[model samples]
Target: SQQGEEDPQALSIQEGENATMNCSYKTSINNLQWYRQNSGRGLVHLILIRSNEREKHSGRLRVTLDTSKKSSSLLITASRAADTASYFCAPRDEKLTFGTGTRLTIIP
Candidate 1:
């Protein structure tokens, strides 16, 4: 599996605070994608930044990719309690090879 690893397996943050997670992979990739999973529901695509890209943003989320180090990071600013969820990074492919994931909790 060309899956990456997310650090700080778990994190707790208060509402309105920012949350950040990092993912490190083993090999070269065509692209990297970030997704969010809430409880038992399906995972939702948050962003997808290609290998040639350095950074991208979507609303309250900002992502940075470092091909040299084979790593990526996701930052969620102005987080709300409703943003609590598990975040995972998956390499671009038909069937994604996802990371262990970061279990994030936003305290109300």
Candidate 2:
């Protein structure tokens, strides 16, 4: 298992519903970060959780880190159609190593 590999490669949800995505990594890390990408554009940083932290939140996004399990999850509350995008988790070292993203689609 490589660092920052996301699960359930794709997801579809209706507007106002919540979306959750999970990422698992192989090695110990200093920090884990989540990002969102619309279409082919650049990634937008959502949240970053340090290995010492258990959870964090920003806006409608909630991020959880479980260092013991080497996993992290992202939760998006009250999802909107505009929230449709590809989400990724990356492990922070000297540089970030991003895994394949999970594509989320919000239906109207």
- What are the per-residue Cα lDDT tens digits for candidate 1 across 1-108? 588799879999999999999999887888999999999999999999999999999999999999999999999999998899999998764468887899999999
Over the full model, what C-alpha lDDT does candidate 1 score relative to the true structure? 0.92
For all candidates, the clash counts are 0, 0
**lDDT per residue as tens, model 2, 1-108:** 245889879999999999999999888888999999999799998888999999999999999999999999999999999999999999776677788889999999
lDDT of 1 at 60: 99
Clashes in model 1: which pairs? none
Estimate every model's Cα lDDT from 0 to 1.
0.92, 0.91
Off by over 4 Å in 2: none
